[model samples]
Target: MRPDPHVDTVDHPHADDLHGDDPHGDDPRTGSAGHVRVDTAALGRVAAAVTAAAVQAGDAASAVPGLIPPPRWASAYSAERAAEAAGHRMRELSADLSGTSASISTTVLEYEDADARTSTRFRAAR
Candidate 1:
């Protein structure tokens, strides 16, 4: 019956600190002097690596059924089918991860390009 940790509760202790306030000084929402830093190149590289690892893990999982022979006992008869299903699901998950990684990479590139353009425009104005 406990509240979900991910959902923000209305009665949170720091909820009042997010907006305009002079009680404790600075606003919690805005960064120092309205500046933020992002490193898209590093993010893209890490995502790419995660994609590769997912694919590799899927490939290894798919090969597991072939590596381990099923037992002759009656209890193990259902286990073979379960193993096959797991391998198939792993491959599907791997493909999904790869697509997500590609999407993130594209987003990172676009974000970096936009940042560069913005910086260039500001420099030109000066």
Candidate 2:
């Protein structure tokens, strides 16, 4: 049978690319990297929402231009920069969704699901 495309049957995507201690996923190397990447998709939606509210609240939409998708990077940059102060914020959104690996793992039903361990206290009471 043909294998699933999303399966971890092939080379890891971000293994070589990711550095030490990545909190979002397992660290390929020995050391742990605490660099947890926030869900950009979530961030984008929230940012767009707040921007929309600003436009509705007496803020000129034309003066701001696009609402849902700001056609330009500069406009989004200023807001993103403000949101993520001190850190270098990139305007481009990450396509990788959260819990993808977990989803893939769960889909593989071949995993053992024998049964939960019987509590000794309950067994003794019987």
Candidate 3:
């Protein structure tokens, strides 16, 4: 029989493994239902895009200010410097967020790949 694409083919929990709290105990792979749900691979792709945009925006924010015409007043220049400092801080924050999102995306994709491989092996064994 051809495998159903919607079904998660991981090893199902045996009757002995079922507990009162675990209602979908028959399918351990799904942890809820027999179906494969929650597309984390798509989420990872979105996260990657967000990370890239954030980093790019941060870089632009850091660089674009230098091109701004300086204020004629000395006091205004100090304010501009302060604003520039804030921009630097924002760049750092964006970089951190990018790193975190990239890490999350990588982890999610890796998990999905591993889960698919394990499920495939389990089905083959059965």
Candidate 4:
């Protein structure tokens, strides 16, 4: 039988504590069994990049309609409609990107606030 790759076999310090096997029935690092760590700096950078892409998408949306020339024949009407639809889709994408950027920013702010509150509590306890 192949050894389970997902399971760690090597013994290490605090391994049992991390796995919720502590004798005291609580994690030593925190009061909980699991922990979450977020890199706000990286999230901020990603939010900035997303915001930039949204701006570019908005610019493209604005330019798309004009790039397609006026319909000169009956058959061209469908092409014009298609171009308009493409532009509309681009606008939707830009809106979605903007929303995503805002969400990321909000998440970073929430994480930072939680960290600050945790630090304050720890300091007060100390």
Which candidate leads in TM-score?
4
Error of 2 at 114 (Å): 44
Look at candidate 4 and give me any clashing residue pairs. none
Cα lDDT computed for each candidate against the true fold? 0.64, 0.37, 0.66, 0.73
Error of 1 at 28 (Å): 3.5
Could you give candidate 3's per-residue lDDT for residues 67-90 as a string of tens digits?
367669998788788888778877
lDDT of 4 by residue, 34-123 (tens): 343355777888999999999999999998636456558976888777888999999999999999999999988877776777678879
State every prediction's TM-score relative to the real structure.
0.61, 0.22, 0.56, 0.69
What's the lDDT for candidate 3?
Answer: 0.66
Candidate 3 stretches with Cα past 4 Å from truth are 1-20, 23-31, 34-36, 67-78
lDDT of 1: 0.64
Candidate 2: Cα lDDT at 86: 22
Runs with alpha carbons beyond 4 Å of true place in candidate 4: 1-33, 65-74
TM-score computed on alpha carbons, candidate 2? 0.22
Q: What lDDT score goes with residue 7 in model 2? A: 36
lDDT of 3 at 82: 89
lDDT of 2 at 97: 22
Off by over 4 Å in 2: 1-33, 59-126
Worst 10 residues of 2 by lDDT: 88-97
Model 1 over residues 1-126: C-alpha lDDT tens digits? 344565422221233454534465433453332223345656767788979878786787767746366568776778777877888888888888888888877877776676777778879999
Better of 2 and 4 by lDDT: 4
Native-to-model Cα distance after best TM-score fit, residue 87 in candidate 4, in Å: 0.7
C-alpha RMSD for every candidate: 10.9, 17.9, 5.9, 9.4
